[model samples]
Target chain A: MEDNKIQEVKSPSLITTPSGGWGASVHVFAPATVANVVCGFDVLGFAVNEPGDEVIMRMTGKPGITISKITGDDGRLPLDPAKNTVSVSVQHYLQSVGRADVGLDIELHKKMPIGSGLGSSSASTVAGLFAIKTLLGDEADPAKLLPFAMKGEEMACGQGHADNVAPALLGGFVLIRSYEPLDVVRLPHPAGLWCAIVFPDVDVPTREARQIIRKNIQMKDAVTQWGNIAGLVSGLFMQDIDLIGRSMKDVLVEPVRSMLIPDFYKMREMAMGMGAVSFGISGSGPSVFAFTKDEETARLITQKLQQHLTGLKIGSNTYVSTINDAGPRVLG
Target chain B: MEDNKIQEVKSPSLITTPSGGWGASVHVFAPATVANVVCGFDVLGFAVNEPGDEVIMRMTGKPGITISKITGDDGRLPLDPAKNTVSVSVQHYLQSVGRADVGLDIELHKKMPIGSGLGSSSASTVAGLFAIKTLLGDEADPAKLLPFAMKGEEMACGQGHADNVAPALLGGFVLIRSYEPLDVVRLPHPAGLWCAIVFPDVDVPTREARQIIRKNIQMKDAVTQWGNIAGLVSGLFMQDIDLIGRSMKDVLVEPVRSMLIPDFYKMREMAMGMGAVSFGISGSGPSVFAFTKDEETARLITQKLQQHLTGLKIGSNTYVSTINDAGPRVLG
Candidate 1:
């Protein structure tokens, strides 16, 4: 009966095809993101060029959801669709877009390392949900689908935050205006800008890192933070690169979070001296990222960061990326 | 002797001519500014369209400085250039630009009322310095001129702050990045937005009002303040009106300062409910300003604020303004 049902729906558009067939399957890739870009704190994020996740979604001839493949993870992720981040994210998308009857077979390629401060789990969730929506013929808007993906990320990180998922799904620089009901604003990508991301071989789980932050901040520090964020946003809009560099200060979060990253302050100083426009800890960070004006500066800064990490007896990987304008896309 | 000195210099530039001379010294107008836009605390400011201070500079052949005329100030302002805000500002500018030998007959048209929480002193200083520079063939850049003008404001307010003065001089939404050396960033001004300024006939001196503020703020509150500022700046860059409204919360300064303004909370609620994007005490005030997307809404908000003040037995003057892009312009 399942074979007969598959034969009946032979269209290229995934939206019209029935859900009970393996033929209506597709792969998706979603880029990793940098959250809390300096002064932005909890509001701003952007997608990077490398170290992304791959998600394959196939419509199983079963009655419910299942996770068929989960390579690269240390055998910890669950196989049930309701328990796994990728499968659960797909389940959420199907439910939210009113396609609850669909049964999904999801295979997550966790290319980026976990606990890398590079939004690895968020990348997987965004890739899986986005692919499933496309396989269903793009029935949901990206903005509409983001909250569901963020929910799946919350299942992993134990908090609902869109700082990473918004950029991972939409690309470029994005501002999460509101978390309740999830509103996001995407700003124009400044031309001739590139980012150098350096991930050291150290693990700092988001939950453990977050636990170290003090519950309260001084009002004076907060004012300074707001001022910096205001300057940063205005700098981006004005395309004032110098102002952007000046405003990349984090008085509230970075001062506390930097204690967890070894040689963080030294690396930041070196990157700045090497002509980086700005430098900051990525996410909760064992990783760090620096922005520059051109490819030459970005390359120089990457080498500088890697050299410093090697001196500290830590292995490192570096990539130079322009702004990612294409967020999540079909693999074809 | 004054007439003889005036006749000695034949140049048309007022900055070059002696006081009581026939040569015209062109004075400029710099718009009044709204500082600390709600949640922005000490960081945000925007130039208003109407009700600006006028600087009248005439060349005096006299070897030293003299303020020849002071009108519209109810005879309260000093005629001596050494003691006056505008004159002191001019002297500071001349010293910074290495033009100390220049003699001037300066006049300040204090059109806007003092103690209005509308940056009256900063307007006067910016206008005076700007006019003097223009008269001297634009000898000083705004960046070099701001510190001097800011000093003039500090003379009146007891502290130097660029949140108002920078925007008043440059004419747009501005972010004060730092106080030392006065770093400023200009933000985009979305067209068609207007501000409604209501000045109740009550005096709250900047010195007295500042004393009421708490010296320390909680760290949690500070974090929320930065978050709101980030949201507001992002909203302005994206032109999201609703987001702008939501981000207009002040946890640090407003609660302390609002006690000086009678019916402050009522006035804010009335204006906000009437479609004002944001409303707050302009500086340290009995005066308050509300932002709106258009002139009509601004007018409506002005009326509502006026009505609220009237209910509290306070009389007020109201003005509507668009963003002033042309700041400190010389008038021949």
Candidate 2:
């Protein structure tokens, strides 16, 4: 333990294994997330079961990293690892762990629609870094990997925020307590809380959705939002379904972001009128979500929402899931 | 059931009786409270055990209200029903519940220091209105009386905010979810959560405190503050003492208002260093509070805080108690 002397460490075997350890490959799946989740603007989020991403990674035989295959996405995602959201996150993780020289092969599957306001980029990024995390044998607490996810977001959207990635990576409900310090908390997840999301076949780019928002909000709005944020957190923990429904309202972010979604007000009204507990834009978007108490209610609402969309003559995807408690997992 | 027909009722006896009922007098006590409760500005607060107000009131001989007596303080409180904080609230309550014709006699005991950041005016007002509420056969919910308390604050502080009066009236930790419709929620109380407060012989008027704070906050600060507010609420509900301690931070209000309190920084540092789970200005300034897990820790902190003030020639009063669950009660 001499001062300033390097400590001894065990060396890994160079030989490849059949499973995803060291030289072998691993497949990781990260769920899609709903950011802002009503009252929490840039702060609260939760994971859903449908619309996620899958990434495959392994130590490469040659130097540096290689992108072997990309699926689901129609050539929209970049091939270069540096330009891709998932690969960029892997790079950040590798560099931070002092393993930048580690050569890797990567593959990505974008199951969720790109630019659909369903946390597509964050899902892919979470899957990528998480896949690598398993191969590298988990050094840091899983929450520590959030910064790498932000790096992925920065590479993909040119701005970084954790509202999506935190929940996508850690599951349950997560609050981004502070951005400058990058602190996140996993709130107590309530049982029987289900979510229904309708992803309309429309695109609202994250960058453009962000640009329309005012840099400063009225203090009046801030106070309303503050109380609701507290109420929303309480609703989730207390497991009071009506309280959660009433609290899941967005006065600050949705009023500004809702312009991008067509018939946003009518759809929200329909959801609420049809027994959805609370309704709001999921992330920045064309995708909207409603929270309900039961799977039957969620399914009924999803059918009505889909039937309502028939008038527009566009194919839309609707999903109902219990709040995803397990965030990312290795594909067995 | 007859349209626009006035219903006949029995005439009341002229003489006022001993107990505050239809023909008697009733004595009511309301406790002074600390608003903002740290990270929640204009949104959160709780009741303290010591330094509160008492009011005595009952039906009068005449068809109007009378301020029979006022004691304590430097004669700042008014006697006129409209001008006095207590009387105006009583007036508002009577008029609101269609009991405006009922006469009332009122006496106020300013047991707590006025302008001490101890919710002096709010306590007196709450007591006066609540006394009448108990006497009126209790038709309206107790929370319905909050507006009358706010009317009192309006007369006293020139602006009405419910943070102080809500906790004083309801007891325990309270969150003002929406001010417009005036939605208030009583959050779940944490077990073994004790609060300690110290009042130095200094006055920082509520008006002055309100003036110093910047109406608009930076978006970055708002996000951080939002997270802390949610965390504080969660901490309280979950009964996580450490989490509550970590979340009781005042980035928005303290920096501005603390300028008015002498040695504020030193006092806060000393309290935190002494194992205060969280420490900050109780409501505005001159009074500071901390939350601790054990009563012994709270007692120790209070004693040391009082001792630390020995050299300053300022006599300070310190109090500690488990978070006040029962807000205000009548004394026999």
Candidate 3:
């Protein structure tokens, strides 16, 4: 690994393509993210290790961005470059860097379920952007890509929230400290932290889930929510798992959103009974997640939750993994 | 300091008094605290080094709690033990430990201003409780006295909130994560954090200050507030002064409460101009605090704020100190 005699791969790229373009194609994978983590509402999220999306990008002679192929989206995602979140965000990135004239062929592979409340669109968008940046050999900081990804989020979901896209782009647990200034802080997490995710097959539109929440909340509830929010963040810093469990409560959003998800309370009770550290709706939700201290408990929680969903005659996908420390990775 | 030949003080006490009583008197000092810290509202507070209360307690031959003397309020405080916060809290503590028969006389010395929005009553109550505990040489945990101290808060403030008392008892910055189970977490802080507190002369009752706030708040504002709360806590842990400054904004309470204080916005503007890290109304109204990196800046800001208050023909007191790491101490 320390061999200085290793051949430089980028020298060949400079001969084949223009100054800003890559000679070879690049494939990138971005992890799925869980937004609105319990009491965090529109501020906090974390990326998971499994169930992500992949994007393949390569420069071409044609002048414009195009989606050559898209898979596993059930033909629901847009094919047009202007309309699709992946292409639109990538186009924005290219425009910002004065490379809008660069031609590119993009292929999106949705390895995760759509509308699963697990930041599916964010994964796809981040993967596409990461692929382009990798191909260009861009040394710019990864956080610089967040605004473009948030634009993708705005296109996908009417709101430009960073809870999902920020974590998907930066990895680990993230706190969107401010929206106007777009201050996103990547926080430290306990090494033993594992997430148990269950995407139950239920048709709950994100718009409808958002509409169901109360626009005006009591001051008492807001006080409670911020307290828990502080506690959860403190727990992450202190690496105290029990404090995290105690503080992962959502009195504002969960009470109303839970009505859309069948057996939400029952699943929470069962998850907690099985030693799950904390459990709550993931994002706007038909999906849910439970935090655990070990991989074994996380796996057990997913298994039990999937079984419960099955008993209700509902299909579900389950995943057990630690937090994704690295945001996006390059694939051959 | 490591000498094992140090005299054991408890041996002489055992011969003169019964199991639950002490022969000698104890004098205690508890630091004043700033509650409702910016975006934290009712859930966060921290102790300051100056302007605290002192309590002197001694065991008597009589059988009940008594307030023998009260000073520094111009006779505003009550002499009756049942009505006074200090004696009432100490009585509750005595009852909880099955020592109601243990006689006590507490002298209340108000070192801090009353109703200055600086938790004056909480300091006195905590000081009284700490004095009794010290006299008895109680080996019980300090946190065990929180419930009893909170009763005094209920009598003084009409709400059993622990934002003031918790920090006064535990020292440092504290977060009351939940009110039901009464969970308090002491958070880490930046070592060089200094506070500039200016208590302007005004008559803003706590009840009226609270009643002025909107019971129902917009969801967007709540989200913003919690994001700032998380950011503030994270900044404290990460020791990021800039992040803490950016996140100390309070959109809900400050807007309404600032109206009660004269020239609140102008002071904030002046303090920010003078290199203060953050500025906001401390506790509720009348008193305001500015955070700064060093003691010199804190002292300067307080002087300017006091000068401004004087220009308006309003009397004010100023304090410059670091966060009090120790909650209460024996004066003698």
Model 1, range B29-121, lDDT digits (tens) per residue?
889888888887777888887788998887666545787777788887878667788888778777655667777777788878888888888
* lDDT tens digits, residue span B9-36, model 2: 1232222323544667677788878888
Q: How would you encode candidate 2's per-residue C-alpha lDDT over A260-310 as one tens digit per residue?
A: 877789888888887888999998878999988788888888888888787
TM-score of chain A of each: 0.91, 0.92, 0.94
**Candidate 1 docking category?**
acceptable
Fnat of candidate 3 = 0.95
Ranking by lDDT: 3, 2, 1
What's the ranking of the predictions by TM-score, best on top?
A: 3, 1, 2
Off by over 4 Å in 2: A1-23, A59-63, A95-103, A136-141, A300-315, B1-23, B137-140, B296-315
Q: Tell me the number of clashing residue pairs for each predicted model.
A: 9, 5, 0
Off by over 4 Å in 3: A1-23, B1-23
- All models, RMSD in angstroms: 7.4, 6.1, 6.1
